[model samples]
Target: MGRLHSLRPAMTSTDLIVPDPVFRRVPAAFGLRWWMAGWRSFMQAPLPWLGLAVALLVLLWLLAELPMGGLLSQWLSLPLLAFGVIFAALLRKRAEQARAMTPQGMPVEPQNEGTLSSTTQRWTGRIGPLLLVSLLVLALGGVIGAVIVMGLGAMFGLGLASFGAFAKVMTPGVGMAAGLGALAGSLMTLLLLVLLALYLFSVAFWFVNTLVALGGVSPWNAVKLSVRAGFTNLAPITLFTVLLLPISIVAMLPFGLGLLVLFPVLSGASFASYHDVFGDEAAA
Candidate 1:
């Protein structure tokens, strides 16, 4: 197994503001390639990768069993989960760099690896900002959802009132207006919910975690760049989603235990996708 090591320079206290990142237009099939790369990375150090995934799952499960723990878990898990995956990717990257630097066919000695204390400190430093960004994103989603609900309610009210007026002319007290209004309201509510979900998902598709963890971008800037990059390469993003759907389902089976393997693969895939989109020049 490869030893864990700090692949990049230590993060600074000063926040870094990266420029708008450029993205490459990859073929739709690259989605599969990303998954393959992730799987390979996981295989290289299965024990550590799987151990991390299992630990996360156990923590989440325990949290979920407590009263109100589900809510607490939801909020806390985002950064913790992100930290593990991104950290693993960082270690994998460092290993790759070390290999590349070695002379051709020369024996590479075991070197100093990143300690747990350093990893925890680095991740803890970033988690606060990442959590804040997540909260802001949630707030945005709530606002969008509220607006859609209100607009739909207003439309339903107006439509019903107009229909009632017309019906009164034909026959007073038929009383079908209320029923029709309720039905329309329900349908509109469902539609609005769907729209809100799609909007939030679009926001997440951008590589925000990678921007923050690897690129050293401030949270807000990472969000902006991620969203921009996602939209700029919408086709590839769509293809990746479509390709991932079935794989995700399969990973959820086996009593959800498959995640031990799948999670690291996903982490690796995320790193690959980020690298593909923003090449070496984009690193902050």
Candidate 2:
């Protein structure tokens, strides 16, 4: 009874996090590894992974019904993300068991469960910090949106002015050229803004959970470090999000069926990414 009970968290942040964590820059192509690891982890225990994904989806759905459910759900996602990391760790341990052999050619038993039991407690203990991080990230999103909107509006305004208003802009020659130029410029500006936000999300916000959960970082520090890490490894971050854009659309196409896999795979990816960026001494 005692041993079985110990399979979950005691809910302590200080005890679970690594002290003074270090981060390494990964190649642009390393994004492939993060997704690959996530995919592999999902395949390792498909049923349980899907079950967890279903639960998370339901939980978020329920949360969305509340007065400020969207905000609440954002805060809640961090701890849940940590749980995803724990599941990923479990999958890793299982893989280790299957491949590890003793000198006698017998499968060797793992000495202990690695980071599986304590991860839940770790993040729960840091819920306050996680909420703060959520707020911070959301606030940044708002600022980014506002700036992009202004830039776009200005762009369209200039186009209209140059073409001598709506009717003139639609005219056959000079107006048409001006209108097209303005349209192209507006589009280019919008694309740049979108990429900027994506860079931050991929480089900065995505890792906030692992930074706080596994690295034991404070909210402010985690944000700072995440942004810095993202900037240093912009290539991989850019590539990962570009590919993820389509996968995300596909995940949504099937009446959200893909979420059952997508959510869990994301958690695994988060786990894999954190370790890859910080797990190795080379990152140091």
Candidate 3:
């Protein structure tokens, strides 16, 4: 429930890389912990997540109440929201888990399998706080993201309209020339804007991961760190973005059922990446 952090600086070139202990080790780059993190996160506090998801889906369903709204309208949003929530939760959890895995002065062991009563207590104990924290952050973030996407959509529509107006008054001989020129110009501008926004968002995403990993920070500070880290590690982070973009698109092919698996793996990898980069302070 608390933010985790490292008192020491990141590992330097002279720092040694030691093998991870068996329980701490991740296999195949991403592992079960990542997947489990997502699954467990949902299991830990499903009602609130489900409520948020259902509310979002219902909003979408109402908006789509027109003729075009079909089974896909009523149901598709539910799954999509679920998929996105699970993915985000996994990322958050992996970041936490990665922090816990850090070899701090206090060595920590994985929680052992126990009876249902004790396990239930362990799970529910943090569920309340975790749900409160995750819901607040996610709600605010979701609203901001939705606003950006909607604003972009409006801008694109306006640009198209402006081009139509320009085409309406052009000379016949010059019309073709001007229309093509306008279309090309508008398209290029839109593309540039989208790319720039995406770059900034990715950076912000990384900062959030960092803050979540490093305990005790507020959401605003997390955003600041993510922005800084994104700028500092632009190269590899961009490389990661390029590599993952296609995979993310492909995962969306099956109407997002593939996300059940893909979400967890990527979530785990994000956590693993954090672990690899900054030694987790939560391990203790």
Candidate 4:
């Protein structure tokens, strides 16, 4: 514990701006480090963490219930998630500090630093950066979505044209074969586009908000650094994403009750990965 605590850099004060955050490279297996750190963070204060997760889930659900709520929720999700990530970062720091303070003979105790209300109030000052990051994420995603839609639409049109040509061939068997081929081509095209969209959006959006909220990075700087960091750490991020698939499914299995635990775990994992890649130099 002492060894781990020692490696952490001193926490930056919230009031100071960190315009340029230093990035570090981590190993491919660092995905496991993220999950383990996340899990340990959850174990440290399971109850409060779970409670906060539940409250977050409930708040989102309620937001989604309002008129035009689906769109509103989508817009707000990133900003809100940044808020949660900030709180998780705080919890992580507090725990590490507590560990550092305990003597060799004493057990490290769980430190519950603040109520959710207090934490929320404390970080409201950073809402501008959080919301700015959120807006940029949505805008980039929107443009990507628009481009992909146009491309897919054109691809579908081509498939339909080929299918129509196949139908006019006058020979039943030939037409059927051609039609099937066209359909297959369309499906493959759709699959490829879907994957491309996911990859592009992931690179654009993954760590932008975290950089802004915790690192005090300006919005534009955060966006660039976030993408650079993504490419720089691609192997680790891919491994981390692959690991998420099964766990995410399992978390969804039980009326989503597992999300109370899983959400915070993922949050911790985000903060952990940030700490590893960006170091522990956070703005508060």
* Each model's total of backbone clashes: 0, 2, 6, 0
- Name the lDDT value of residue 4 in candidate 4: 25
lDDT of each: 0.68, 0.69, 0.48, 0.76
Across 157-239, the per-residue lDDT of candidate 3 in tens digits comes to 88778877877898776876887787788779878877887676655555343233222234454455555655655555565
Better of 1 and 2 by lDDT: 2
Better of 2 and 4 by TM-score: 4
Error of 2 at 81 (Å): 2.5
Clashing pairs in 4: none
Candidate 2 vs candidate 3: which has greater TM-score? 2
Candidate 4: tens digits of C-alpha lDDT, residues 1-284 = 12223221223464554358788778999988889988887887788887778777888899999998887788788777766676677676677677778988898885675635555764575677777777787788788789888988998998898788769975888888878877997899799879867976785556787787677677778889898988888878888888998999999899989888888788788878888888754433
**Cα lDDT of model 1 by residue, 1-284, tens digit:** 23333334435667463365676666767777787878876766677777788888889889999999976786677676666656555656565666867998996532326633455666776776768766655666578768877877787677667776766675444546554666677678768767656854664545877776666666788778777777766666666677777878998889977888888887777777777777765442
Best by TM-score: 4
Tens digit per residue, CA lDDT, model 2, 1-284: 00111122333546665355677777878888778888988877787778778888899899999999988897677777667876676566556655554455765544434444455555466667667777787788778778877977887677666656754536577667767777777778778877776666656676777776656577788888888876777777677778888999999999979888888788777777777776633111
**Which 10 consecutive residues of model 2 have the lowest summed lDDT?**
1-10
Predictions: Cα RMSD each: 5.5, 5.7, 12.0, 3.6
Better of 1 and 3 by TM-score: 1
